[model samples]
Structure formats: C-alpha cells, structure tokens
Target: MQNYTLLPEWAKQEAVILAWPHAGTDWAENLVNAQHTYVALINAVNRANAVVLLLCPQDEIDAATAALASNNQVLIVPSEYNDTWVRDYGFLTVSDNHKNYPISFTFNGWGQKFDATKDNQVNSSLAKLCQQPLIENSIVLEGGALEIDENQHLLSTASCLYNPKRNAYMTGDEYHTLFIECLGAKKVTIFNHGHLEGDDTDGHIDTLVRFTPLKGIVLQGADNRPHDPHFAELFKLQYEVSQALPTHKIYSLPLPLVLDDEGTRLPASYANYLIVNQHIIMPIYGQSEDKNALVIIQSAHPNYTIVPVLCHSLVQQNGSLHCVTMQVPTNTIKPEIIAKAQLGVSIL
Candidate 1:
C-alpha cells in the first residue's frame, strides 16, 4: 500500500490556486463578473495564504498578467483550461509519512459533460512550474468530489461518483478501494442525499457540506419554512450524517438565496466555505439565509475570523467559492522549493 494519506482543506497551506476566467470560455459574456468574484477570493486568500497561482490560457495571458500586475502576492502561470474550476482539474496533494506530493488523476470533464482538453493539461504545467512531483493515476477523480475530515474519513456523494457516465461499472465497495489505494484514507462516507438544485457537478460534496476542524460539520439545512422547497431532503441528509458520524459535532446552516442570473438558479451554498489558517472564507449572497449561516458558522469556529465574500457573480457559472479555489497543504514541498527556491523543506 502507498504510504501517503490525503488531507483536509482545513490543513495548513502553502497557497491557493485560481484559474482566471477568460474571453475564450463560457464566461466570455460575463468575464468581468467572474473576475470580480476572483478578485475577492484572491485578495482574501492572499492575506492568509502565502501565494495564489492564477492560471491563464494563452489568449488571455497578457491581459491576465496586466490585470494582476499590482498584485505581487499572486503569480500568473500561463495555461489553457476549458473552465475555471481548478478544484476539479488541478493537483491533488497526498502526503507520505515523510512528505506531501501532488497526485495527478484523470479528469474526464466530470464524466465528459464538458470539454476538458485544456483542463486536463493543467496539472502537467503546474508540475513543471512549481516543480511539484506528480503521482499519475488512471482512476478518475476531481478535487471537488470528496471532502475528508481530520479523522482520515473521506466524505463524498454517490450521485457524482457513481453516475453512469463516470464510474457506473464499479461497485460501491470497489470505489472505496480507490480511496484507500489513492488517498490512504482510513474510511469512506458516501452520502446519497443532500444536493443543491443548480449544481451541475451532480451533488459534489463541497456544495452540500464540509468537514470542519472542530470534528464537526457545517451542512446545508432547510428552515422547513414555506419558501424552502427542499426541506425534507436536507433534513434527511442531516440525519444521515448525524447518525453516521455520531461522535462529532454538527452545525446546520440555512440555505442561502437560491441565487439566479439570467433565469438560471446558481449553486449558492454556505457549506462551500474555505478555511485557511485561523480564517474562514465564506461566500455570501446577501440573502437573509446568509446572516443566519454566518452566525452559526462563527459560533462553531470562534477561534477563526470569518471573512464573507460576495459571490453573486461567481456562481453564475453554477459553481461558487469553494468550487473555484484549491488549497495547497503547508506540509508539502517540491524539490525546487528547497534546492532552488530555498523556501526550506522537511519530511513530514
């Protein structure tokens, strides 16, 4: 068996990766809006995270560089990708007992729903630029598909992973084997419930719930009011997690605005928050639900300063805060970081 184990996002980080939206992709008409969201995310992460890598396709490389010219806290790595969801196409860092390494897995456009030719080559470029070593694998996976906690338990949803177009041939037990084979996780928790309506990724766990540092979870819950249509399903999901992980704490966050733009409801989820160091970066939609979720999240994490980001435009493409950002674990080290960049490296 491999010695490396996958890590939770709440772990210490070196940097966060953001793939800038350009004029070439679907965000062409709303490129400005996408950038607006990214700016907030980049700025917030820069304060706590050491570096932010902005991936730009060749066509937009010059524009991206100029736009970020004043932001020295970030680095621009010229590359092409079908979309800006780096959390799905970017590197997957796994750590041996000694060090953390980026594991490269094939991303078939979340089961070929979209063109991924450009996105597929992202990690290869990153491996060369950051000089991050790659552990290539054939089992398809995305960074957004799973949410593991500090306890070595991998959490995910069956809707996305077990979809017919993705891995229909594999049994549930066999899929769990890949978690062990690839991530070194101790156990697997696959939820069949809890999903955002507009989420195109087929119930990605990030949009439904997240594992918190307090051995707790922040799940999307329905207020059971008349306006909340998915009350029953969300409530069932809460019970599923509560019963499954009985020893941990649980905080249910109210649903944010069923955010929409141009007649499409975006995946606005408070559960899709990012934690960096002692900071909690949450996406806010300026809805009544936003305030309640923040209070509950803050109560659960009194030690961290909660930073709410206005992500109205960010979700226009059906993904929100956590969907666009990929955290680099602090414990990882590339050969260049030590032998060349001289940033200091130590075996875990």
Candidate 2:
C-alpha cells in the first residue's frame, strides 16, 4: 500500500473547516450562544486563513451568511450532518510525495454512540465541493482522535482507537498496521490512561495532549481542586508523556471546573486548541484558566497571533476549538519529494 504522510495541524493551511450550529440540530437550545463562538472563530480564522463554515437544514444558510457577511474569507456551504463535530467527521489530509489528498475514514459518531449516517458522507461531499483528491477507507477513525508530529509519529489513545464499538476483533497491532499503511504513520504510540469525566469520545487525544511546534507537549494539568474526578489520571498523563518525549519541553495549563447546572461535567481542555497558518484559536470557558491557556500558547508561539473563542456553550455539546475546526493543508508533493518519501525518507 502507498503511504499517506499525515500533516501536522501547525502547518500552513489554506482554510479551516467548521460545521456551524443551527436551530434544527442538537445545539438548538444553545444555538445562539454556540453561533456566537462559531462567528468569532470564523472571523478570527478569516483574518489570516479561509473559513469553511458548513450549515445544515438549507434554510439556515441565509442567516449564517448574513452573520459573517463582512468577511469575504468566510465560505458558507450547505451540508447535512448528524451533529456539528466536523473535526471528527471531516476529512484528514495526507501528502503522498507532495500531492495532497484527503483521507476519509468511517466515523461511527464517536464509537457509534450517536447518529453518523449523514455525518459519514461529509468527506466525499467536501472533496467534491473543494475539488481535492479523496482517498476513501473503511477504517473507523476521527480527526480529533490522533496527534501527529512533524516526523509523522501518531499519538493516540487506546480507549478510543481500540474500542470494541469501533474496531472489534482487530488486535492493537492490526490497528497500528492501519496507521502505517493508510495514515502514513512512521510510528504509533497508544497512551493508555487519563480521560475527562464527561467525555463521550473515549478520551480523544486532542483533549488530552497537544504537540507543540517547539517539540513539547501542552498537556491538560489538574487544578488545585484535587477532588476532580480525573486527577489521578492526569498525573498518569504527564508521566506517560515525560517517558515518551524525554528531551521535549512540556507545558501544563490549569483545567476549569466547568459543569452544567445539573452537575454534568463538560469536556473543556486548553489542549484542544486549533493551530492555523499564523494563529492559534484556543477555547475559553470564561474561567481564570482561560487567561493562562492563552499566555502559555502565546509564549510557545510568539510568532503567531493567539485568538480565544468562548466555548462555554460549545462545551455543553462536548467539544471546543480543535473539535470544531480541521485545517486544509497545502499540497506540496513534488516528484523528487515523492521518490525520497517512497523509500522510507522524511518529507520534512
């Protein structure tokens, strides 16, 4: 099988894909608040990179377009989806010898925990819409579930990747094989522990650990509130990464105590930030941690602009900046780059 080199999120991108919230969807109640965050994101991203905003229920198009009418960088397109988590349903772009292609893997709505029939067709629809080459695969995966370094080493979690609901009967080695043969993974590491309390996506890696462009990790550190349910697991998270990247610089940001009035915890993590061309669109929950998150990211990438998008309502839907935005990487595979990469060489 020809390998597909996975591009890191920190690379230069043409556009950021966002599935906008609407009244006829699950975000109907939080529709106004959610759209506020989405609008902020669209505007921020458009300032530096193009914003691909996907709207459902055709009727909602005019209103969505009207909101961001000022920004010519915002591209509004009608779409059909089970929900608005496009990071999980959207296409993953990989470079095979410089030519870029979008990889479409089966999204089972976070382990088939939700409806994904329409959401599953998103990649093909998007490929036709963008006129990019689409590489279709039946492997169950999500854009938010894996982290790739500049070296193409994939960092993912065991709970989400190997769950029986996603890939039953397939051993861990078999799944690792898919990463190599399909996703262009030179190596694969499965972090076994640590998860958020109300997380439904089986501890997606984006919410747990983020790869810093500085060869470090921006991990979700536990707050002074030692009673947080996932405190013990967070310790394990730090230890696991320290063991993996010994020389890498690790930065820890405080976690917010964001739970619903009914006491349901929301999956809020500073590590779930979206890194675009020259901007870092981070998630803010109106907590003090929001400032620290911004400061830490800004310090790490002083060259890039840091934009914070209020995700209080979006977390109610169990996601944040990175969960909603997937970047479109530039296709740079030339003939020489492909020839070297084909024989187990680095494109970087």
Model 1: per-residue Cα lDDT over 175-256, one tens digit each: 8988987888899999988777778898898888788788888888877343666777788898999988998788888776
Best by TM-score: 1
Clashes of each: 1, 5
Question: Model 2, range 1-348, lDDT digits (tens) per residue?
Answer: 556888998877766777768876788987888888887887777666444435445777777766664534555556778888888988888887667888888999888889899988777666764434788888788989999989888899988887889988888899788888888888888999879878889999999988878787888888555787888889888899899878888887788989887898888888898888878888889997787778988877778888888888888977777888888875532233323322321211
Off by over 4 Å in 1: 69-71, 130-132, 224-227, 331-348
Model 2 scores worst on lDDT over the 10 consecutive residues at 339-348
* TM-score of every candidate relative to the true structure: 0.92, 0.92
